[model samples]
Target chain A: MIPLSHFMIISAALFCIGLFAVLTKRNAIQILIGIEFMINAAILNFVAAGRFDRVAGGGQMFALFAIVLAAAGVAVALAIILNVYKHFRTINPDKIDTLKN
Target chain B: MSAEQLAFYFFASLTLISALLVVCMQNLVRSIFLFFVTIFSLAAMFVFALADFIAVTEVVVYVGGVLVLMLFAFMLSNKELLSGLQNIAGGFKFTHLAGLLICGGMLFLLVSAISAADVVNLSWIKNGQAISENDNTIHQIGIHTMTRYLLPFEVVSVFLMMALIGAAHLSRRERRS
Candidate 1:
């Protein structure tokens, strides 16, 4: 049996990568992609932890809800990004600085 | 290492490599495709962890639904934006170094925490006997969702509906001005 630490290590690495993507990416869509990675990394953690809670499967249930919410969030974010593109002609977050003082 | 360890390592590498590619790849379309690989590897990791139901849901909802929606949005956006390979003209110049430092620090901290922590054998087998057949996760999850988790389930449904409406409203083309 694979140790639980293995899963934890993988999820941690995934989370860091996602954080890097979110912090460094300038494109709105790329930021959204990073957010998805981060969410999936958390989901991985939940499912891996759920492997221990075999009785109620609360972790799995929470993971399900998280996945649903992530899909909803992505849908809304993509729409917003699309609207931003329409108004600004560019999806780069830095270039869309109309609100800057 | 056992077969399980081998599979775990394979999926873990797959997920981590694609995730790195998703962040590092400058081409937007290529990055999106790499994101797909990352999500798929994550689902496979879920399967390795024995969350079969979640794995299937990840594939259906994330790969089938969310990714298709993202692709549609990408295609619908400007043509020049799609063809350009260069990143945003002058963004991320200063932040790259800062982001690298922060993320690298976070990774080091997390790894250290995991290593220093006590390793408990949290595997599901209780006592000498395995969990009974009725302990099948899908069934248990269904029961819990209807009972203990009913509120969250209903809330998620409402949230999804609201999001659908909000996205439609937000993306609608302006007819005025």
Candidate 2:
């Protein structure tokens, strides 16, 4: 059997990549891509840990909910990003700092 | 290595590589398309982990649903604006390096913690009844969703409904009264 920690390491690396993308990517859509990575990493962790809860399948159950919530969130976020694009005529997050000035 | 180990490594590598490509590729359309690979490989990983039901859902919801939605958003956002704009995010820079450094440190911390903790020998794994590898998780998931998971199931449906309505309202072109 592959060690559970191996799974943990993979997910951690995935989360880090997502974080790196979020920090470096100027475009909001790309940032959303990063957020997807981070969310997947988290879902993977839940499934890994829930391996022990054979009786309830709580981890899998929660992971399912998490996935649904993620889909909803991405949908809403993209809609909002659409609105931002409409108003600013650009999707680069850095340049849309009306509140900063 | 055994076949299971080999399969695990294959799926895991596929997941990681596609994910990296999704973030690193300069072409937005290509990266988004690569995300299909990432999600499919992740679903494979889920199957390898004995969460077959989750695996199927991952493919259906992510590939069949979310990616298509993202692609629509990508097109609707307008090709001319995207193509005409300079892609500043594709370049390397000090800030990007700093972000990489910080995230790499986090991964390092997580790896060390997982190793030091020796998660395989945790009390729950030691004592908990392991789900037989062959037991049909789909059946159990169904029972739980209808019985124990009933409330959350209903709420998620409602949440989906809200998203449908809200997104339609939010994205529609506004008109002056």
Q: Mind giving the per-residue lDDT tens digits that candidate 2 earns over B1-177?
A: 999999999989988898888888777888899999989888887776678889889889988878988888888786665665344544678978899899989988989998999999999988997766879888999998998889999999999999989988999998979
lDDT of 1 by residue, B1-177 (tens): 788788889989999998898888877778888878888889988887778889999999988988888888888775787556474544556699899999999999999998887445433433223223345677777898999899999999999999999999998878986
Which parts of model 2 have CA positions greater than 4 angstroms off? A99-101, B84-90
Per-chain TM-score (chain B), model 2? 0.92
TM-scores of the candidates in the order shown = 0.90, 0.94
lDDT (CA) per prediction? 0.83, 0.86
Error of 1 at B95 (Å): 2.3
User: Positional deviation of A51 in candidate 2, in angstroms?
Assistant: 2.0
